[model samples]
Structure formats: C-alpha cells, structure tokens
Target: MARTGTRSTIGRTPPELWPSGGTLVSTDLLDDGSVDAIAVPLVPAVEGEHGAQPGEGAADVSALYGIDLAEIADRVGLTGASGESYVLQLPRAVGSAVQLPWQALPPRVVLLGLGARSAADLRHAGAALARASRGLGRVLTTAGVQGSQSASQAAQAARAFAEGYLLAAYRPPTSATGPAPAPSAELVLLGRDGTRVTAALDAARTAAAATWLVRDLTTTPSSTKTPAWLADQAKRLAARRGLETQVLTPRELSAQGFGGILAVGAGSASTPRLVVVRYTPTNASGRHVVLVGKGITFDTGGISIKPRESMVTMKTDMAGAAVALATVLAAADSGLAHAVTAVLPLAENHFGASSYRPGDVLRVYGGTTVEVANTDAEGRLVLADALAWADATLEPDVLVDVATLTGAAAVGLGKQRGALFGTDDALVAALERAGEAVGEPLWRLPLVEDYADAVRSDVADLRHVPADAGLGAGAITAALFLREFVGSRRWAHLDIAGPARATSDRHEITEGATGFGARLLLQYLADLR
Candidate 1:
C-alpha cells in the first residue's frame, strides 16, 4: 500500500531552539492549553541545572532514563531527554520516538539530532522519518537543531534538512494509476536565526523537487518511458523552465552519422533519440559544464541475453539520464554561476533479427570503431557516441558522464558508494569534496593504462568487452571505452551501478531506484559556478 503523511504548521514558536553546550527548560506539566511539544536548548548552563553534584558526576540519557537503550528505542524513537548530559557534537544528529510518542502526543515527537550528525547522517535520518511516518500523516511542526552562530552554517543545515525530506518522500505515480499523492505538511524552521536559512532551504527545496520530476520520468518502465517520450519530457521541462532544448530522432542521428547509438537501438521498435538541454544564466561568465547521461531506458542484453534477475532493474538503466536532467534543473533554479548543458543518449538494447551481433564493428561519432564482443555491453556504445559529440561540439569546460554501467562496481563498492574515474585530478577532487558535503559517498578508482589494452580489439579500434571473460575490471573497461571519445577534454566518469539502487533495507529507501547523484551533481555544479 502507498504510505501517506502530513506536516502541520499552526503556531509561532521561538527561534532560540538550538542549545549550545547543554541546557534544558521544563514545560508546564499537563496545562489546559499548553503546546504539544517544547524545544529545549542543550546549552551549558542547563547541564549543571539538570543535576551534577560534586563527587557524583551526571549520567548520559541511557543511564538517566534508567532503562536499556534498546528499550528506549522501542518506546519513543531515539530521542534522549532524561536529564542527562549529552556531549554536543557539532552537526551531530539522532532521533527517538520517545521525544514524541506517536500514539500519545498530539503528533509524533520527531527529535532532530544535530551534535554528532554529519550532513549525510542527518539526511539519512530525515529520509528514515519520512518512511516511518508514511501514511500516518505526521507533520514536522517543530525542528530542534543545534549549531554555531554562523548564519551560513545554519542555513546549510536547514537546506540539507529540506533536501533530505523532499527527496526521501517523493514517489511518482505509476502510469497505470493516476496522479501522485499530495504532500502532507508544510516545512517550517524552528529557531529565530532561520530567516536567511529558510530562504536558502527554500531554494534547495525547489531544486530537489525539480530533481524528483526528472528522476520519475527516467525511472519509468521502458514500456512507457520510450526515447521519443523522454524527448517530450525534456521539451516540457525546457518550456516550463525557459531553457533551450532540442531532440534528435533516430533518423537524425543516422543522418548526423552517430552510428554507435543508432546501431545499438536498431533492434528495438522504440528507436533512439538524443536530448539536449541548455541553461544560460543572465550574468554568467564561466565556461559550461556538460552532463552526459546513458539513457538505455531498458536493456535486454540485445543479441546476448541477460538472466531474469539481471533484467528486472533494467528500467533504472537511465538513472544517469535522470541526474543529467535534474542537474540542469537544479543549476537553473539555484541560479548557478556557470552555463549548463545536459545530453541524454536515449536507446534500448533488445534482441531481434536486426540486433547488432558479436564481431560487428560500429563506427561511433568521432570515427572510433568498436568491436561488439557482447551486445549486453551496450551502455558504453551509446555513451561513446554521446561523449564524442559533446567533446567535438559543446567543448565545455568539463564533461561528466554518469551511468549505471557495470555490475563490477556493485561488487566492489556495494550500494553506499559510487565509483568515480577521470583524467583530470582537479575535477575529480571537486566531485569528491562535493560528495562529502552532501553525504553522498564517492570513491576514486584506478583507470590504469594497462586495463585499456585489455579492451583493444584485434579487428577494430576497441572491443565491447575485454578478451578475458572471467576477468573483472568491467568499470575500468567501460571508462576506457568512454575515454576514447573524451579525447583531451577535461572529463570525469561516474559509474553509479552500485548506488543507483538501494541494496538492503535502509531508513529512507525500501527497494526501487534511489535518487543517488541528483544532489551530488546539483551541489557540484553550484560550487563550480
């Protein structure tokens, strides 16, 4: 069943909510018209007031509650407020249902963990709350967060909170069904210093919503999210956002001589397309950042069939496309400093008589030829053409291509970290830093020159798959294939096969596609600007 909830906004509350050090203010007990919950500042003065006698040091919440930590979790979530001194760690975050009992309180007690919580941890916790309260119609009427007096830092936290909630709760309605569910509540900042923070958060929320809009379209099943249909979506978003847009059909690609994309998509009845979206800010003077996404809406392994289990999540093969489109939207909404360009190479890999076979050499966009060793390795083929086109035509300051390209990435990093490989160290460093700031973990993998030799074809310029069947390095080989097209352009390749889909049960996601790189790319672009 679909989960539902709401966040109510009804009262004017004090902004002095974040307590530095550790302090507590007790509310009037059981008053006739008292508020549902009160925000207590964890300041230093209250630490002594809570009871710290000489020779008898105070205890933490676990000891003060006089119960096991697990039991407390069972009762009221993870909020710890039993007259104990919690070492306030900057940006730390934790939650407890005890802070607000869902059944007893007017609304559930949603505690905001600030001290020990990293930005990513807070985002993770916020997403969890969205799921836990799904369909319950719970609202975040009050938020208790702590930080220094810096307005930007506070604003950063507020923006993070908003992005977390917005992305975690978004669900696109299935085409067979009707519209998506309505939002449950209004998000309001809890403290006084939130005026500027609120505005920053509002900007971030707008960007996140745009991300959801694009991701939903990308994640739709291939039966529905066809190349032409995806182009329609790009056109709609462009018209709405006032960005420049163009859609090239299979015939156009063939005429333009983009044989790699055309050849891979020839077997499918859906055909193929290349979507381009451009956003130029009014006062921007910086060079453009081009985002290329591999939009294989579905992959059936072409002439080479995949196992049933491997084919189940093929709908999300376009996750990179989702991020590409979402990044452009985010850049425009945030008024980023640089001009942005997004290129989505959309196609399908299916089996039919027309399907390209093994040993067939494909001449991609930049005149590079590739030997099709495995038709299932079609993502690289499409991206090779797209990347070549981007380099030769757009000639942006930097080129970034994101794709759910290889299973080897999943085997290496699991689902929490995305693997990044590139030719430019500075560009890679910027992405790494951006990933950390947003709580989206990214790791750099080697693109050894030795690996490139493995993909070299005896008959053509390159082979779709390496010569050795059992040898891994699939991610490296995919990146190597893409490198040929990038040429000398500053480029980075993100293999999101690991993080594109959640691997296990998490606080925010319960299976299905995760909006993995939307925030990372958004923040990275904003920073570059």
Candidate 2:
C-alpha cells in the first residue's frame, strides 16, 4: 500500500551536517540555548532497594538546573528503576538560572534507564528517547552518564544510542492520507572528545540509513516491486553511486543458460532479471568479494502454492537481495578500498499455466542439472544461478550468498539470529564478528558433508530439495546444494529466513523488514579493507 511515487529517501541531511571528526568543546562552552531537550542515562537500583535516590547523572542535573531530581522521582514513583523513563519540564526560573550559560539552558530534561548495563539495554534506552523526542528539534546528551566506561566503550555506547534513535524514528506509512511529516530532531553529543563521538555517530547513521533502505524495499508490496522494478532500482542506484550495473533480460538469461532463474520465473508474466552491481574503488585492494542475493520479488510457491495464511508476509522473501544492494551502495558511499560485487537474481514465483512443474530437469547456468522437487524451494534455484555465475566469472576471493530460503532455519535458530553456513572458518569467523558488532546476530550451522546426500538426484546431478519431508537438516541440505556451485572457494551462506521480518517491534528494529544482513555484510567488507 505504499503511495505511488513515494520513494524512501536516503541521507536526507547533507554530509556536512552529519557528525564527523572535529575539535572537542567543553560542556561549559556549549550554548544550552541550542538544545531544546537534554537526555541523561540512569542505571537501575539494586533489588529490594527502597527510597528513591539520585544517581550520578541525576545529581549532575540537580546541581546544574537547581531541580531536585530525587524528590521528583519520589513523587512520581520512579526509583531509578530499570527500563523506566521519566521526563521533567523545567520552569523558566530554574531553566534560565543555571550558572554556566544561564541564557542557554534547555527547557526539558529526560531520564532514561540503562537496564542491566548491557548493550541491548542502552539501545532500548536510545529507542525510547527517540520516540519521546519526536517533536523536539535539537537534543543534547552527556556521554559520561551512560556508564563509567572507557573512551572506546563510550564511543560504542554513543553509536548504539544514535542508531537506536534514528532507526526507531523511522515511519513508513502505507496510506497516502497526507504529506509525510518531516524529521524534527537533530542529535548533538555533549562530551569532551568531539572527534571520536562524531565519527561514531556518523558511522552509526550511515549504517542505520542503509538498513532503512532495505526495509523500504522489502516492505513494499510485491505488486509494485516486480523483477523489472527491482532492476530499475538497481540501475538508478548504480548511476547515482558511480557503481557498475548490468541487468540481464529473460532472452539474455536463456541465451546464457540461466535455467535456475528462467525456470523459477517462467510462471510469472514479469520476466526474470539478473542484476550485477559492482563497486571498484580506484587502486582497490584487489580483494574481490562477490555477494549473491535471492531476489524473489514475490513467491506464490508457483504450482506448489503455500497456504493462505503463509502467504501474508511472503513479500519479504526478497530481503536478502535488498540487503545485498544496500550493502554495496553503503560500502561505496563510505569509500571502502575493497572491490565488491553484488549479484541479484530477480524473479517472481507465481502459479500459472506456464509455471515450471515438478520432476522437471533444469540445466542450471554452469551446465549443472537439478531436479525440481518442491517449487516452494525456488529461492535456492535463483541463488544457485547467481552463485554459479559469480564463481565462473568473478573469481572472487570470498563469496557469500544470502536468502530467505527455508522455514527450517527459523525452526532451528528462531527469530533471534540467522543461520550461517560456510566452508572457510576464517570467513565464517569474520562474518560472525561483523554480525555481533552490528547487533545482527548470526549462528553458524555446520555444512554437514553427510547431508549432501539429501539433495542427490536419481536422474539429475542434484534435487532442488529432499524427496522426503521427514528428513532432518533442512537448512544444512540447502546450504550443501549451493556449495555445489562454488568449489574450493571461500564461501558462506546466510539463511535469513527467520530474522528478515520482525514479528514485533524491539529495540531499534521496526515491525517489518528488519534489514538483517545489510549492516553485517557492510561491516564484514569494511573489516576486510
């Protein structure tokens, strides 16, 4: 239900306005008049603790503004409790009476809880602040109040806070009832080391905005975002970002023998497309990394249709492709030195007279034959073609493929993390570190060599899926099938079936299109550089 012509905007503010490395300034030197709201972090009191007491931050606010924060907490039943938030409006007398920069005092003060003193807690606190400060124009925060941590830890906390705030502030309405509201708030970090905090904030904003782009693409209804539409988007992005783009049509696909993509997309009226996006920096490090994403714009499961209930959120099946596209663009925007390429195989698996049938033998791109067992396993087919193409042509140093491939992945990892399968331990370890650093957790699942037999075919080289429904290791079997394309190369497969779509709002993640791998992959590529 996205409004026509209403595209998601990226980097609304100019780069100059974005926080960056700069000279530090004292809190005393900052003009309070510039800030409409001031946010301070508070930790929870220990269990069985009684009367309201002033935390260090509250004490600082009390002395700075002449407001008794402890008394206010007592009256309002706030005990510096975990996950609790309280806001106080300062009267003109107290607001203007501050000793330092009395004329520049903020009118409102916010107390946010740091529950458990964990990273998750800090992110939630930041999300809460973002929701509360929706209408406020300029906000300032004191890094010292988050916790007694080192400079590195403080920068991390600041980055988390900024990410949470910006991501939670996003609202992509489906209805075109009125013009979308403009962003009202601007963030300012109050600390001694402006350069460090600025760099952290800038990085967080870039990463989060890229995530939002993925969310926008995935959340758009399938009807509006067909395979051609996705190709157009990639072309536009490439043009704007100075990346190289190539989109192959159905005729070209047939000529090149991309049977996997052609077979899966044959059912739909919209033809299939394979989009290649490359970012080659000047004098690049020569570390070629290829990323392949399953771009099923919509999945009706072809002839093997899903249940009515199961089809509700199937529009998110292309989340992997969206992440891939967003990751490459973000890397280019950040001026990374590594050479990156994204292969996106775009298609729609629909049910029609022309739909490819079961038991059909498909000679995939690299001349490997595959027997179609379950049409619902179409994501792997498209991904297989791109993987094979990358392997044959790109000769990448590291190859990664991402897809919302199986429900069994959700059954195994739940929605908290994606299932990662890889041949190289070093690549797997690096991806895990990146995922962890960006809060997109990935759990490594073994590519059981024994499970390779599950996908073996009687007539062809392999089967699209196991013939037996009761067979276990569904996620593993899918990964093994992809491994057939990339032989002896460092490869990793991310089955993001569970984490691609959010079941409910949590922390900085919205209720749809979680943008799972965009930031993780970008972080991984950045680490390589």
Score each candidate by Cα lDDT: 0.68, 0.79
Which lDDT tens digits does candidate 1 get at residues 463-506? 87898977788888888878888979999999999888865546
User: What is candidate 2's lDDT per residue for 1-529, written digit by digit as tens?
Assistant: 4422434443233111234222113354236456677766666566686544554345666667766666667677765543456777765544534644223577777776666656666667777777667778776665233446677887777777677777776665443555765563676655425567667777777887788788878987887788998888888877888889999999999999999999999999888999999999888866988899999999998989999888999899999999889888888888878888999999999989889989999999989999999899999999889999999999999999999999999999999799999999999999999998878999999988767888999999999799887888899999999999997789999999999988788777878888899989988987884
- Misplaced by over 4 Å in model 2 are 1-34, 46-57, 74-83, 89-105, 116-118, 143-151, 173-184
Please give the range of 10 consecutive residues that has the lowest summed lDDT in model 2.
14-23
Clashing residue pairs in candidate 2 (N, C-alpha, C atoms within 3 angstroms): 32-104, 33-104
- Alpha-carbon runs more than 4 Å astray in model 1: 1-107, 111-115, 132-144, 176-182, 192-195, 503-505
Candidate 1 lDDT for residue 157:
60
TM-score of each: 0.80, 0.90
How close is each model in CA RMSD to the real structure? 8.4, 3.7
